[model samples]
Target chain A: MDTTWSAIFTEMGWGMVTMVLNLLKVLIPLMVGIELLLHYKVVERIAPRLGWLCRLLGVGPKTIIPLLVGLLLGVTYGAGAIAEINRRTPLSKRDMALLGFFLFGCHGIIETTYLFWVAGASALFVSVLRLLIAVLVTAAAARFFRLAETRKE
Target chain B: MNAFTKVIVDGILRGLKTALMLLRVMIPVYLCVTVLKHTAFFGVLAGAAGPAMRIFGLPGDAVVPVVTGIFTDEYGIVAAMSGFAFDKAAITTIAMITLCFHSIPVETLVTRQIGMPAWKMTVYRLALAIATGVFTGWLAGWCF
Candidate 1:
């Protein structure tokens, strides 16, 4: 290893500049888009309408709130919302687990996907594959737990 | 709505804050990884881990980001792997896996609070992340 530490740092400094610039380009627009979506209450309106998705995830209608929140805002916020909801009406362990699994596979879709895309992954691949995997795992678990048939009554 | 302008401003602020947060961690990690790549230790470690990573169509050095991602988050992974060269397939695999399971300690608390056991969620996520990595590796090879 003939390369000195300072030399590596100098190289890394240049690399960082380029990387940060590329990241910011997409990130700024993405954050703006997210803010617009939130400001317009897109998730709020769209979440409740995903009853079929809720059914597919093997949870009741209310579970959609945390699922959507987690998908849009990331797991912490989504889980925070779930904690709030669970306090008012205790959710079943199965419901919580299903939500956890699904969100684990695909959360913070907009930012995460775009960030990875900037890092060289395909945006569509990251977003679609994660969502697909999340759905598959959650739906399978829901079936195994016999909760998928819990449609809106 | 008049508030639309405020929303855009908020977005820009939020984006700056997030970029700063990521840079705080990423810059140091990137520098460290870059230095480590020149070290004999990293070479040995990479050699040992190479086959395991090869299963996912990644080089051994790729483990740095994957493991960093487990302890930290996507930012850490990005920083850790900054110096390495990977094709799109490998990057996609890493992204898919890390996205499935990152920031375990903090997120595990969220899961616990939400009524799921921390250990269970952790295990599920790790398993799913690996599964996703393998699947993405295969898919990317065929597609990308």
Candidate 2:
């Protein structure tokens, strides 16, 4: 215990501060860019292409920006987009639950890429596996949410 | 506000709010992971978690990355993973796990605001991460 405490002070203390700084370096800029995109309502233009997939995912057009943002960027950014949707056009509980499942297995493209690069991980394996899991879980969630909704009705 | 002005101001305010909210979770978790690494508990954890990680073809120390990735971000996991000589297959599996489950603290907060249960999102991500890790681990074993 004494050695651990001393080690924390002498070594891990500096490591903690540096790691947090490293996180801010990546996250802050991403958040700011996402906020600006939201302010400009980029989703309005970008989401049209998501039409075909929307029905399949059980999410409406409103969920596109958030879902894509989370899939392509970070979940925090996606959450911001989803919050915007709730403020404007609320999603059904089923859709919201469905989205939770999709974002679970897939979020943050760059983070995944960086992990692959730094950790000697294979890009293809991670990408394919995550996409597979995301689609499967999302499909199951949609089915379950739909069944629950029907029962409620 | 003019269109140009609105974009800048809204971004600044919204970004600050989002960053602060994220920091609330990120900072504490970062500190906890960092401090834990300095303690003996990390080794004990690695010992216990080794078997589960072996299911993904990873060594026991890989637990640090898995735990860090779940709670924090890529950097934490990267920092945790840097020293080890993890093979290509183990790295791939770990990457999938981190991509799926990293930043649970902030992401769950976001989900709750979007009208889902935070715990549900966390559970969903974790389950999927595990599934994918297993899948990739198997793939790695088969291919190489």
Candidate 3:
């Protein structure tokens, strides 16, 4: 066990530093840019426009706040934002399930977009495909489960 | 409202909203990254599980999320994916599979909180995730 531990540590020691540095490089700019955007209320105006579209996927306009946040930020943050919204507005189980499905396909947009870009793929293609898949899958799941019918009155 | 003023107001508000929303997200994400880095246990587990992961075309170090799913959840799995270096097609396929079913502990807990049966959610998520992973991986490998 000791030998195994040592071997693993030796290999990953360098990776840990690189990982930390890389994470900071990506996250710092992301946070700063996001802060700038929020300070200007960019997402606020965009949210209403997306409401009609969100409804088709079985989510309310309220849910779009976290979905957009998750896309711009990442999943953990997205989930955190949703949890906060749910606390205040109280989402239904059906809505939560739908949100889960939507998130499964499309969170961490910027990070994933950058990754695709670095890999020689079109970032727009990746983003659009992910959103398309998320919407289609969520819609199918919502329909299959009769989520709308199961909603609390 | 005049066109120029409306445009300026819209742009300024939009920018502010986006920034605040970003700050909200960055705090939690930064914490997650920090904890993941300092933990020695994750590296050990990843090493131990390395052999089994290779069968799926993942690196030996890739077992961290699989192991994490046994205890915590799939968020760790997604975090793990962010740390690796696979081709675009491979990463997307793996991510799809992971997103479908990787965080057993977390998914089960959340589903139960929402009143779904944990066992059913587990079985359903796992089965769907594996099926999706295999199919997508094969298709991606073939096409790309």
Off by over 4 Å in 1: A1-6, A147-153
Residue-level lDDT tens digits of model 2 in B29-93: 55566677655787999899989888988888788778777666666566666545677877777
lDDT of each: 0.83, 0.71, 0.59
How far residue A54's Cα lies from its native spot in candidate 3, in Å, is 2.3
lDDT against true structure, model 1: 0.83
| lDDT tens digits, residue span A60-115, model 2 | 77777788888876676778778887898788777787777887777776555644
Worst 10 residues of 2 chain B by lDDT: B22-31
RMSD to native for every prediction?
3.0, 5.3, 8.2
User: What TM-score, computed on C-alpha atoms, does each candidate reach?
Assistant: 0.92, 0.71, 0.59
Q: lDDT tens string, model 3, B50-130?
A: 665544555555454444434433334434444445576556555555555545666567556644345855675566566
Worst 10 residues of 3 chain B by lDDT: B69-78
**Model with the higher TM-score, candidate 2 or 3:** 2
Q: What is the TM-score of chain B alone in each candidate?
A: 0.92, 0.68, 0.55
Candidate number of the best DockQ: 1
Write one digit per residue (lDDT tens) for candidate 1, span A49-108: 788998887887888888898897777668777988989998887788888888888998
